[model samples]
Target: MRKKYLFIGLFIFAILFTFGCTSGNNPKDSFQKYVDAWEKQDYKTMYTFLSPSSKKSISEKDFIAKYTNIYNGIEVNKISVAPDYPKSFKKDSDGNTSIPFKVTMSTVAGNIKFNDTAYFSNNTKDSSNPWSLNWNIKMIYPDLNTDDKIRIDKTFGKRGEIKDANGSYLAQNSYIESVGIVPEKLGADAENSKKQIADILKIDKGVIDKALSASYVLPDMFIQIDNLSMDDTDRLSSLAKIPGVMLKKTPARVYPLKEKAALLTGYVQPISADELKKLSSQGYSKDDSIGKSGLEKIYEKQLKATDGAEIYITDKEGKKLKTIVKKTEQNGKDINLTIDSNIQSALYDQYKVDSGTAVAMNPKTGAVLALVSAPGYDPNDFVLGMSKDKWNSLQNDPNKPLLNRFQATFAPGSSFKPITAAIGLKTGKLDPNADKNISGLKWQKDSSWGNYYVTRDAAYNSPANLLNALVYSDNIYFAKTALDIGKDNFINETKKFGIGKTLPFEYGLDASKISPDNSIKDDIGLADSGYGQGQVLMNPVQLVSIYTSFVNNGNIIAPYLNAAKGTPGKILESNVFSQDISNTILNDLTQVVSNPAGTGYGAYMPNLPLAGKTGTAEIKKSQTDTTGTENGWFIATNTNNPKLLVLEMYENVKNKGGSHYVVPNVKSIFEQFCK
Candidate 1:
């Protein structure tokens, strides 16, 4: 009987111990779990922790959706949730627990931080958890309440302006009219009216039909067909009498320089769908404008507008209650270029009729003043909206009006002689005063060259010396000079002038090539390359930069576009040639222009002291091919001030006096700037 009594006592003690443990539940621990789920953006887990009364107020799906939509709309990220609570659990007089918490996150508008209290019910009845959150809209946002809505408001900033060195507009914000048609107002002759519209707008009739046939279009709704610049829309005044034609003025990007600066400034258009998807996180929308080409595209970060945002609480009446986040809109920074508008216009006016490209730069400062690619299409057409027919015409034009020739490379022709001469002098292979015993207008290194031979202008059959060779543009002299320098030495020396390397400039320029794969195959190939023929191609800007070494005491100046980044006299390759060699070459090039017998004599002008070289690069399948074309090249600058260095190239100058065809044209531009 005593043993049974002892067993009963021990069992009762064990039961009491289990009951004590179950009653030791802390509300702070439950609150911590809810805060953790909030930080992870786990709305479902947070919903499961809500009190029965809170759950009855909002459905689980609606709760999760509300958090998601609001967070995404405001671009919320980097979420943090911290709760301020005591070490021990305590209950208020009403049998509830309240814990203060802080919420922080990054948004497009800016950072958001707020503090609020989380209330939990102390009653554990009919629930597995000892604590349940008494959730409400205030728990999501401190300023939010029932029947209140969270809203995001956007304000767009103005796009920046592109200006010349004189602060003249190259590209700027302006106005245009959106031309459209309303089908309901069109008379019985709707097809005829569309034909007339197509003719006026230079568009296809099918384009109008497709736009009107859209599923979203209504008979009275305005169906936009094309846009026209405000300054150029006078031609459309006759369309006002038409039944359905309408013009709505809208903001647009305008190019004042038109075709003259088209390739330099490029143009802007509405952002594409793919671009929007990629840039959504950057606060970019489908309605935003994006740069398409040229400087506009390259400097997009500095020229694009920054949108401002405001996240606020609104009532059912659509009245704003409180602002949770605010960001000020910032306009894009204006870009000032080193381009001189006067020089840019002068070069374009001179080269507009030819199939060629011209570049004028301040050789000493490395400031690229003018870049003109002739047969240019107006950039304003792109901004005003181009029609299918107009676009096709530009694409089909034999002259290739759309090509940015300045960005392309071509054979330097005789223009590359200076480089070869410098290399020859640097390698100590050629004596400037010593005359080479080369004869005839055409010569080759023995019969190993077979039928292939280097030909020179018949006008220059004088004794072959360094000065006379450069002045006469004697191909055989330079070819013989290259043979003396050898292949390995020539290529290694050429690389010092930035060949086979990327140019450090804002504009994209093709790297100047030395030879096929940077290697000369044989003596014939080396001879041809020495005169800038065999795979010796260079962009106009790079050619101008290399020429700068002659005036910069044998140092190549790095060419620059944006005025802000241009450091005057910034050396690209230091000491490419010794001071004595540079001076000698400069004097020889000067004589080529001033002397009547010189090949570059066409460019000679009195009192201007111009120095330059002329080149004619032949394009043919073989050396003996009679049906071949020639590209004319001219590099000229004032030897005194050494300020403006110009390079001009014209295609298909065969039987047109070769490189001399562009020499006079280059001289006229210098007259406008200097004389």
Candidate 2:
């Protein structure tokens, strides 16, 4: 009995051994081992193949160290040896026989399943001589049941809509369904799929061919182009009939007003390298979107939308079967602005013909009504991608089409007279009645000076009183006031007026408006500033705020910004100041604008009941010209309404028949708006 049992065990062992000897070696693993041995110059293995280098200088140690490290789906799985391929004798470019070998690549890099077949026939003519991969890797990314799998997902959050102040949709958010595919699932037809898709999308077929032919491993499917005429929401329904394509729902950024508020609203682009690095450092990927310019950039965190990722469950055939993991996308915070889209649109339409800015704000609340910088672009231009031609035109334009001048420089011109008037009254140096004594003041320095004219027969000129000073925008009249107030006091007063500072707003800003220097005590400098020239400058909004202070009774209120944090909304900060000199500046300014000979007579707005001043400063024409145009300006405030301030500036040079050119432009806008 013992002998019989032992014979049975031995027979079983022999059967097991015979089976192990025939198929025990993992074909894929054994093939790799043979390749590794051949690489190391093992004579036995090398005998079976041609030596790449006759010298065989690399030792096994060196060979092991030199092996390239690649992380891929194949590397992740324990692959089995494949069946031997049909004998092939392929000719090289030099007419050498091509060796044929077969390999059973795993379904994917990590998954152990396999489908399809790989036939390796040596290709001696391809330029790159790249290793070709064959066989099918079932995509398990989407669920096994095609209908149950998700093709694409929102990046992180639900998309937010863009709306105007009146709750009108200007730029809105919507979802687009797109079809995606796994290259391996198509087997030998991946190339055909690429060509077909490219042709349907009306793109360069070569691009598709290159992408498809170069793909050795299955790559993430990105739907580059889609049916433009078809409804985005119904994309899946139409595309399901397309070959090797799956459907996914995704949200895209959109622009509503298009070119209307393009410049102001700005545009969005794919995250840049630097921007991507910023996000990666914050634990985000390169797919995130960031603001490129304008309001979007200024308020990136608020306007930016959030995206969510989809966790796909794929079948063994490499087809997405289901989503076992998913987090609901969270949309980004919505931003409500102070800009009134309708008014801004109207102003932009008018400004399209000119290069200027239009700003409207409440004198009391400091809330900006419409802030416009001309030459607006279509914000949509930046949504998908910006063309180099469009970008170059804007960059190279002589008019500085992309620059925002509303809060930048408006060339104080005569509009600056209001501030000088305030400086005079604020410092207590102007005795509104001081000009009553029309005594000629001497130029303390006899040195050579700029184009300065102190009336040699000053006594002959009309009284240079504060009223007459603002009335005529007399350079000499205010020059006397500056000298009386002194430069130190002037600088201090100017800073208090909020110059050389940025207002808190949603749009990107230009921080160069007001500059005051005590060193500008020269009769020329002081005189220039007296009538709004030399070193003094202000923007339309700044001028409005300055005049508003006078109307607000000594309160120097900070400019209003549309971007701030509030309850269910953002609230901008408003700083107010009430100094003792309030009454002085207001009373004197009223007298100046009311004066019959006042240079600002044209500024009189009966319905608005405004007080104002006008100015014409001689500056250089352009950067290179020695003579610039006569810059015209008008600034006003209505104590009766007490909520609106208006400032007008015109760069009318003596060249284009002077004031006939630009002043009328400013007048027309003011008339339409104020009325």
Q: Best TM-score goes to which candidate?
A: 1
Model 2 over residues 329-432: C-alpha lDDT tens digits?
45666666656776666666754455656666667777666776666666665664455767898789887767766747655665676666667766667777
Model 1, CA-based lDDT? 0.87
Model 1 TM-score, 2 decimals: 0.80
- lDDT over C-alpha atoms for residue 587 of model 1: 94
What TM-score would every model get versus the actual structure? 0.80, 0.62
Residue-by-residue lDDT tens digits, candidate 1, 103-137: 88877788799999888886557447767888899
How many pairs collide in each candidate, listed in order? 0, 34
Q: After superposition, which runs of candidate 1 have C-alpha atoms over 4 Å from their true positions?
A: 1-152, 181-196, 209-223, 386-398, 459-461
**Model 1: lDDT of residue 210:** 95
Question: What lDDT does candidate 2 reach at residue 409?
Answer: 69
